[model samples]
Target chain A: MRAPLAERVGNYLLLIVFGLFALGPIVTILVAALGPDDGGSGSSGFGNFGKAWEIGHFGSYLRTSVAVSVSVVVVSVLLSVLSGYAFGTMRFRGAGVLFYLFLVGIMMPTEAIIVPLYFDLRTLGLTDTFWAIALPQVAQSVAFGTFWMRAYFRSSSRSLVEAARLDGAGPWRTLWQVLVPPARPALVTLIVLVFMWTWNEFLIPLVMVTSESLRTAPLGLAFFSGQYTSGFTLLAAGAVIVGTPVVLVYAFLQRHFIAGMLEGAVRE
Target chain B: MSSPPGEPRKVGYLYILPALLVYGAFLLYPLVRAVHLSLFEWNGITLGKFVGLSNYADVVADAGLRAAFGHALVLIVFYSVLPVVIGLALASVLQRAKVRGLGFFRTVVFLPQVIAMVVVAVSWRHIYAPDGPLNDVLRAVGLDSVARGWLGDYTFALPAVGVIGTWFETGLVTVLLLAGMARIPRERYEAARLDGAGAFAEFFAVVLPAVRGEIAVAVTLTVIAALRTFDLVYVTTSGGPGTSTSVPSYEVYHRAFELGQVGSAAAIGVCLTVLIFVITLGVNRLADRSTA
Candidate 1:
């Protein structure tokens, strides 16, 4: 019933090699951040963090990232749940066509839309502003969120929504009171996903915001590396600073993240 | 779960309006508008000229742009093809092995997926630097002649960058294939064994045919990453040395933002979008036919 011993050993060997490939860069960076001063390549203790923080201007980038990601999550979650509720629970004349239209939104990469969007935002005088960065991400997240939640609502317990309706509750009340509370896991997964995507997003902020102060974490890190090309220790510390929040969140909620990704792939 | 409301009414429409508006204005409109822009010549600050089909021609005719597309295709070799093959190999063994610490292995391997590409690019840039660990290993192992500044060298730059894509993607492909492999019936493997199949024979006859959907998904995602990669190139090489690693997305960025070639960028964007659409659709269709 089991694989042969040699085969088992071979699998372990493959896993070990893969583990090193994946974790090696991360460990190297962490060591260069916290390990002993190998001359300028690394500095002992946490001084690199402080120095990278100041040199990279991470304080402003962090704020911009927080502001943009939170707004994206909140707006995306609200709009998606509402829309998903309709798409799932109600029938309409153009539902199928509209659903595919959103699917177009899902399939359309940022590369495809970003050019016209830049000019469009420029005409609206919003380029170089945070709204330029935040709005498009909200749109991207909502596209996925709507599809994801609609699927959830369709499969979830119908009795709850029916009971609320029978009790003369309005649609809004039914959605918020009867459904939203129980939909915490789906919403959390969506929020975490939107956060990571928005946080890691590079091109939009790169294209939209020319203002140094408005840079998000990843964009700021790119600029930081460009400026401190030779300062391996500082750059490594900066890389950690930019990547750590998402990694920590993934560490904590990896189960949910993995589940969402798998299920979402089916949606795709 | 519920039947259509007795009549579709204001509420259904109202609930969807906000999401549709954002998606419409930002995603849908821009896509359509981008296609529109591809047909004309207009700088962001200028009165436009109408130039139909020229930019698309340039996408093909311009040596640099064509090279960029070529680089993306080359990346597909490293990013998509190799990873899927490697993933299948890993999945085959792990499926048979009943490996311990599989969760830990899975998490660590998928680490690249979780990290930002910019961070991945920066870290690898250092690793590929002259005195970095990779070259150190090369020298220590008595292969010093093969090691150099990977991201800077013309000959090795594209492959070096592709290797990063490989590293990032191999984990994802492995995990996805493993997910598909788990659903395979035990009897199938037993059947292969009964047929006097070797490992290669079993893999080709049974395992390969079984995980078509996973392969489809993995290829689509990795191919898209290869074609559309931006952050990695931007941070690591900036399409470097002399355009050795420029992919279309980077060309789109460079033209629009840096060179002020708005129409050309839009044209390339439309072309890249079509390429992605056609290829991914073809992949999915092929996958479905085989599996079904």
Candidate 2:
């Protein structure tokens, strides 16, 4: 049954008002990015974007973002898939205890460990390098990714695994051939999520590295806003430049990403 | 979950070794080292004498640390409590409204969840600027006396920062609650109306209890956001206006990086993690009780 017209109107009004509150700042940035600012972008043009692009050296930062995210995803996902398969399909000694240990990863906030991790990386001489950021993030992502894929694999039909094994497929072959093809949704969702988190990571970069050239996009964006304080158009342009990559990814994979997030939250 | 004909193979440890090694080296080892460092008086570089819990003493005694923890809890009021309340209200309204363009509204609302925190902070910094739209709107409505540098005002800065957290969290909580509410049968709402239940009664008696697990999920997520917030606070105020907004995460960064006081930072970090663990455990236990 449908709601009464009065109630329907009230709900839309409420949603639209809150939607404005949610999206108002982004719209503010959008307008400022496109509009004019004194002594920047001349007048009524998008040269602010060009100027922000150059001033922030966003090109280099974007490259760093891509490199770090790609490495983290590849390394984390490979490790997670292997571990997830084992946890899903096989029973080892201390299996329950070990899985609980991995779940600890979810509870430990990045802030709690990053302070000491900075020193550890410096001792290992990995500070100011990509590995410093990527490695810890890879661990974090794999913790979640392993939990995610393990659920997927556990719920898969055992008959499929048995059939593949009966046809002489080893465990590795069964995983590659029988399980993974059907798990593409979970895999893609994990990739998109890990990519977003790693690309958008700021604190690890802020603490771990001081080199300007090696800064990730979000870190570069913060510094750019700090330096270009008087240039609102440029600041707005810088924001869009930094945030647009993840927004694009979200727009493209909205459904899978939302499903994954909700599932993760519900599980927690 | 299935009972196998033979005993379960223990060789699966070999398959998980690579992951466990990475987890141990990067996560577990760092955690252990953080605890170890917390007991000493060393800076980041040098080997130093053990202080034996004095750094933790500093964390307990310091006024600055207390304020940081207080600010984070205040943020929980905004980031978790207010959002959850608002989410429940929204879900109650939307669950029966049969609205068109539901997906579009959901996207617009959830858009903030995906944006970079640095970007969110920067965008909000503009909104709270002295000459920003907020002030302009205040002036237009003839309430110009109240407008100030929100992120700079001592009384308003922490709440100003909390508002941003609230803004980001509301959509997420609302969507989560709505997802849970979707499972409630429509006829239940009709039955409530047949018994002369008004909106408030219908909601509290039916919608709210049905979504207990979701309320727990929302609380857990948002409380964690409040407790562990770093990037947003970093870019916005830098824990400024005389440390009115210094969260534990910010303090950890400031101590370890700026002051190079490694031990106390580790101590505070450990304390913060324990607090989060306790709160989350309590939340889950309470949630499980309600659901069961």
Candidate 3:
């Protein structure tokens, strides 16, 4: 089934070009980070990362981002599994209507709701706190997570559930003891997606928290770039600092990430 | 009476309650409130006056607002159209050659999607700086006259921003289409060759139809990404060089936070939401029809 040698070579050439396009910016930034410090004045190597970490206050921002992402992922994954189990395994009144409501969360642009969401959170005195950033994102991630896990649960082994039920196991026990263990792959995918989205979210933390310490990594990076416009090395190092965790996670769980994305696309 | 697993009793409602509560409180409620706010002139602090549809009217009449929406549409060309076209071409090449390192290519190509948009914007902003790699390359090639600040140039800013979108999105589209194209049976390709169909003819007769659904999915995701582009514009240009790269999402933030035009901002948000819905619905309809 192989094509001619020339065509194969041409394919490789094109793939290489596209690969360069994709990898070029990432590689350049990494290289620039390791080059030197601000204005190329300070010592070279990993010192830039240290300086950027201190100056940008990335330690605080990364902490905020981690806290927000962890809270969002934990709450949303648990909620999505519960709800997805319902939608997948059970047919109840208003199921269709409720599922469509969840779909609206998936489809609704953040621009549509962010303004009111800010005001609403502010009214409750939740703004400028971690809950303000984490809770709203929990809602968003749960929306998509429910949809994703529902698809997984619906196609999961039915006989296992039936066997568990015949043994007098309750619905909760069936889900936890019988089904959830085998659903590790789907759960991992949900965790990865929700974590990435929560980590990379910009506009929410931008508007929700005005305190300098509460700023997430992306927000802090944006402000840092603005402040250090000419400090290319420092800025590049800061980007690496802010971006490395997600990159590392993606490198490890890329299979789940890709599978979830393609599956989501096809289902849509 | 006990119920089957597929038809669990009213307790099913309880299983969904927690998620439904949070979703409604944060997302759904805010959406409704945004629509409600769109109809009034509120300073965001005081009790607002009702302005009826004047905010919507303002969105239509204001030239800058109109231009912002226009920039989003232009971005669709770069974000959705260009990526899909390039993705199709790349997938076809791989399809023909049965590429060996497809897994490696997919991983590298899909890397951009995983990074933060702010990081993407920062990296690209560096590349587009006056003396950045791009201009350096141009000067190296003796095209020094063409070298300029890309994101600072009024005319080039939008496309410069758009090209970044293309770069970030092309990999996603390509990977998605490749997944779709891989499902085509080998015998179909062999049959097409037996019919003496050339590459173009084979693409139209066999490949295009097979991946129609993927194209729609790509368009939906990317078009939505194009319209909802705030982080990129916010980081890269701030809709700068005279609002040349301003988009609705950015305007939604700028108007409310900066200009104190909450009502108009809400109106634009409502419009953007509707625009996204209508366009995606239209895309799905067209895709379904052609495949049928």
Candidate 4:
């Protein structure tokens, strides 16, 4: 049923207000990025993007971000699927304890672990390396992904698993050939979230990497802004450069993103 | 779904072993080590003497540390309280009036969440500059006296930082509430209307009770965000303007890396963790009680 015209106008007005509030800063930065560099060196329009890319050394940073995000997503998604499948389908000894251990990883904040983690990794001569940045995030993502995919697995079709087993399919065959195809939505959600977290992670890369070449996009953007404090146009362009990849992925997969978030809220 | 023929009861352990090992080494081990290190007085490079909770004592007695925790509490207002209220109001309005382009609106609002916090900080830092758009607008409207460098002002730095949190979080909370509100069966809204319920009354009788779970989730998430806020604070103010914006997480980094106070940093980290747990549990319990 439609509301009265007065109420409808109010609704539209409120929505516009909120929409502007959310998109204003983003648009402001984008606009500034297109403007001429404040230092009178870089060209106007999209030329600023190229200038920022070179000056900020975003090529190297983006490469590292891609490497870290891809590695984390691949490893964590695989691990989460295996563990979630086991937990959702099996009843084994110590399952509860092991799952709760993962839960602690999920709930434990990174600040609490980073100090000792740095010291530990340093002792092992792993600090300032790719593994130091990627591995911890892999573990962190798996902790959440296991919980998410387990919920999907738990509510999945039991008859399908039974049917696969009756057909002489082993656990591996059942998971890959029978169940995973139907679990595409859940997997997509997990992939998107893990990728976003790994890409946007600033703290781990900040604390772990001292090498300029190993810096991720967000860390590079931070340092660039710090050094080029006077060049607003370049800084805005750098911000856009760092932010665009995830935004593109999000725009394409927004359904999975929103669904995963709402599902998390409902589960809570 | 019974075990396959000849399958052992412990076969599940094989699948979980790799994940469990990594998680234990990277997350769990470090957490326990943080706890242990919190109990000692060490510069993180030498043999440590046991302090036996004196670090915890410093967490209590140290004025700067006390103020950092207090700043986190203050941030909860802008981060959690304000956003939840705004979300509920927005969701309730939209629930009462079915608006077109709802999808477009939701997508636009949720965009900030996808951006990196460092980028968000940079954009807002430009906006909050002394001669920035905010001050420019203020001068244009003859409110010039109200304008200042928001993140640099001693009085306004924390609130300026908090407002950024508000901007970042409202979208998540609103989207969650909207999803929750949408699930209320139309028949219930009609039933409330049939009982002579106005918008406020209908919301109180129906929409409010229905979305308690989402509200709880939003609160929990935002409170956690506020407490664990390091990226935004680091990039924006770096706890500047004379520790006015210093938070526990920022302290966790600065004390350990800059000040060589590894013991105190660990102690602060442990305290922050305990605070998160207690507050999360409290919110969940309150949500449970209200819903029940």
Candidate 5:
């Protein structure tokens, strides 16, 4: 049946409003990045980008962020995938209780535990290092990641696992050879989601690492803005530098990202 | 699907061991320590006397913390209500028509979600500066009288920052609502159209009911985020203009890290967690009942 003209117009108008609302801040930032420096002295050019790159010392910051984020994603996905296979495919005593215990981590926001985590890291002598940031994030990310992978695992056919078992495949070999291959899409989805989250994370890194040398991109942006108080163009340039990778990743993988988020949210 | 029998159970425990150990060390242990620390008055570096509920009393008595929490509640309107309404409306629209470049539109809408909050805050801070783009636009459009320092002013700062939260979070809400909308069978819409339902009527009767689950999920997540708002406030105003824009998280950060009042910080953190639990439980229960 053909919809009425008024409805179509109204729908289009609604979409346009939301589209502008979502895109407005980003466009504003992009313009600011390309606009003249805050003093209104220099003409608009790529000058801010060069200054940001030089003064912000973003080279080291970029490396630290990439290392930390990649480490967290790789560790988180591996742990979640293994745990998910066990929980989703195996019959185990106390499995239900253990899985529910993992869910508790999700309910407890990182902010709640960050205070003691600082002290704990200090005692362990791991403070001011990449492990301090990477370890906690991996732990936190694993809760959601495991939950996601578990859902993916549970939805797959049990007959496959049974078939693997009958074919003389041990549990590890079965998971490695059979279950892991089928779970590739879900694994990719989790990796991208976790990568994006860890990349954009700020508070944990800010609280954990006090050394300037160890700052992540988000922390670097915070520090850069503070140091370049009057240099709005440079700050904008820094934001772009920090925000660009995730934006680029999302541009290419929007569907997978959205699907992953929806899957994570809808399950409970 | 129940787990089979005996052998795999051993493997399951081993599989979860690493995650369990890490969570215990980092997440669970710290939480317990935070609670323990809430009972003492100590700087982060040095141990002090046990205060035993005095810190909680201080948090309760402090006007600054209370005001910060009040501001956080105000933020809930921006973070939870505004984006949710906009997202639902947008999702409703997208559901009705297949716009050209819909995928591109979705990408643009979801862009802010990928950007860090610090970047979003800095960007908005510049826009809200006294002589920034917002005021420039206002002046150019002949509305020069209305222009002001959006983040620097006492009256406008919190809402201004809250609006950024709305802007940043609306896309997630939109995506969730869209996913929910997708689950609504087309037959229901067809039936509504055949019954001479107008767009509004059909939306109210068909789409709204179907996406109730999505709405619940969005509100719950957004409310949690609103309560925990810190990065934007930290980057923009640092809860400045006499703490007008301070939220609980910023207050906790300040109390613990900046002032060396670890106990009070933990108290605030504990209180914030309780508040979140209450609010989330209430929302989730309502959502559960509706979907049930």
Candidate 6:
């Protein structure tokens, strides 16, 4: 059906306005990052990126961020896949209660638990260790990840599971040979989403790891801005450095990224 | 030909054990301890006398805490309501028109969601600076009197920061709405059009009702994001300018680590958790009932 001419014009105009509103901050930041900087003058050129790199120690921060995010993603995904299979396909006593407990983990916010988490970590003498950040995040990730993978498994065709079982395949063998391959899309989606979330997470690292050397990229950026409060250009440059990779990922994997988010949102 | 169901069931229990143990150690233990701590007074290194109900009392009585919650509500307006409205409107438009460069437009809009919040916060802090682009535009338009320190001034700081939250979030909401729109069967709209419905009428009659679940999901997520408004505030304001932009999460941070009021901080955390849980449950129930 053809839209009326007036409606078409109005829709295009609305889209343009919304597009600009969405893009305005990013464009403004890019321009500001490029502008010349004095104590109060406007920022200019690529100089700020260099200055930000040097001043923020962005190189070291980026390395730490990459290491932490990758580790979290790998560990979280592996554990989630194992547990998701169990929860989804297999029947067990107490499974319903155990799953409900995991659901409770979903509602518990970081703020609600972080104070005690801090004390817990402190007691274990792992306050500033990478594990302090990674372990809790992995736990949090498992709650959602297992849920995600379970949904994927439940929705998966039962014929394959039955066929594998008929071929004398055990639960573990079927999961490895039959289920895992078909579940790859969901698993990939989970990995990317988890990586993006863990990489961008701030509060966990801020509270759990006080050592400057152990700071993730987001924490480092916060500290960098605080330490160099007056340097807008440097801040903008640092922002770009930290923000670009995820933006690039979203650009490329727009479909998967979006599907992952929607699945998480609508599933539970 | 079925195997005994009980054998596989036993294996399933064993399979879930590792995840359950990890969850028990990290999430459940900490949450229980947090609730327990909220009932007493203790600094990290020292155990003080029991202060039952006083921590809760302090959270309620504190002027700053009240202001912070108010600020969080303001953020909901900016972050949750505004984004949903704008995103829904845009989704409506995109659904109606065959726009050029649709994919590019979608990608650009959704870019902010993938970017770190700290980066977005820092970038916007510059934009809100006294001599930044915002003030520059204000001056250029002969509205010099209106321009002030956006992040530094107490009056504008909270709202200014809240607007950044809006900017960061609108894209994700748009994508979610768009996905919902995509799922709406085209035949329903065709049927509506055949019945002589206008664009607005068809939207209300068909598209809106179908996407109710997505809208609920969007609102729930956005509200939680608004309530947990910390990263941007931390990076940009640090609850400064007389704590104008402090939210509960930020206050919890300050109390727990900065002031060493671990027990009180735990109380605040508990309050925040309960508040969020109740609100989300209410929202979900309302959404379920309305849609049902």
The model with the greatest DockQ is 2
User: Which scores higher on DockQ, 5 or 6?
Assistant: 5
lDDT over C-alpha atoms for residue A140 of model 3: 91
Comparing to the true complex, what docking class would candidate 5 get? medium
* lDDT string, candidate 3, A92-111, tens digits: 87788888789878878889
Q: If both were scored by DockQ, which would come out higher, candidate 3 or candidate 6? A: 3
By TM-score: ranked, best first: 3, 4, 2, 1, 5, 6
Task: Give the runs in model 5 whose Cα sits over 4 Å from its true position.
Answer: A1-10, A36-44, B1-8, B193-196
Writing each residue's lDDT as its tens digit, candidate 6 over B260-280 gives: 888888998898888877877
DockQ of 6: 0.59
- Give the per-residue lDDT of model 6 (tens digit) for A159-226: 88899889999888998899999787898789889989898999999998877789888889888888
What tens digits encode model 4's per-residue C-alpha lDDT throughout A79-128?
99998988888778667777777776766789999999999899999999
- Per-residue lDDT, model 4, residue A225, is 89
**Residue A108: error of model 3 in Å?**
0.7
| Worst 10-residue lDDT window, candidate 4 chain A | A259-268
Residue B125 lDDT (model 2): 93
The per-model lDDT (C-alpha) reads 0.87, 0.86, 0.90, 0.90, 0.83, 0.83
Tens digit of lDDT per residue, candidate 1, span B1-292?
A: 2353333556788999999999888888999999888888887788878898899999889999989999999999999999998999888888777789988887888878889999998889889999998999999999989989998999999999999999989998998898889999999999999999988999898888999888998998889889888899998899988888899999899988888889999998888888888877888899888877
Q: List the residue pairs that clash in candidate 5.
A: A91-B3, A92-B9
Candidate 2 residue-wise lDDT, B105-161, digit = tens: 777788888899999999999999999888989989999999898999999999999
How much is the TM-score of the A chain of model 1?
0.94
Off by over 4 Å in 1: A1-4, A36-43, B1-9
Give the TM-score of chain A in candidate 4.
0.97
Candidate 2: deviation at residue A161, Å? 0.9
Docking verdict class for candidate 3? medium
Q: What is the interface RMSD of candidate 4, in Å?
A: 3.1
Each model's DockQ? 0.66, 0.68, 0.66, 0.63, 0.63, 0.59
